[model samples]
Target: MSRAEANTNSPKRERIKRKKQQQGRKDHVEVCALIPVFLVSRARNLLYSHLMNSR
Candidate 1:
């Protein structure tokens, strides 16, 4: 169901909260893509090292 349909039986506050959450998720995805590839690769290497050490 759409946001409007889902908030049909809810109050204005709940609708506003849901709207903000949806917008935040979209913003996060956009920012994630703009991150530098070098930084991303470094992060991946760090995580891989951690995983290897834990195993």
Candidate 2:
């Protein structure tokens, strides 16, 4: 490809990459916030199971 074409494409590629990274970051933050809730629910179920077994 010509140098001019390459230079034009570079900015477009960078913009796309930046958008994807921002989306990924948002997803990660949402998942991170939910992780503790998931773990707590899992632990609660485990405890409940043990209590039921002991009965």
TM-score of each: 0.44, 0.58
Model 2: residues with Cα > 4 Å off, grouped in runs:
1-11
Give the per-residue lDDT of model 2 (tens digit) for 1-55: 6999999999999999999999999999999999999999999999999999999
- What are the per-model C-alpha RMSD values against the true structure? 10.9, 2.8
| Candidate 1 structure, TM-score to reference | 0.44
lDDT (0 to 1) per candidate: 0.88, 0.99
Q: What's the true lDDT of residue 49 in model 1?
A: 100
Where is model 2 poorest over a 10-residue stretch in terms of lDDT?
Answer: 1-10
Off by over 4 Å in 1: 1-10, 36-55
Say which candidate scores most in lDDT. Answer: 2
Q: On residues 1-55, what C-alpha lDDT tens digit does candidate 1 reach at each position?
A: 7888767757877889999999999999888887887688999999999999999
Per-residue error for 34 in candidate 1, Å, reads 1.0
For candidate 2, list the clashing residue pairs, or say none: none
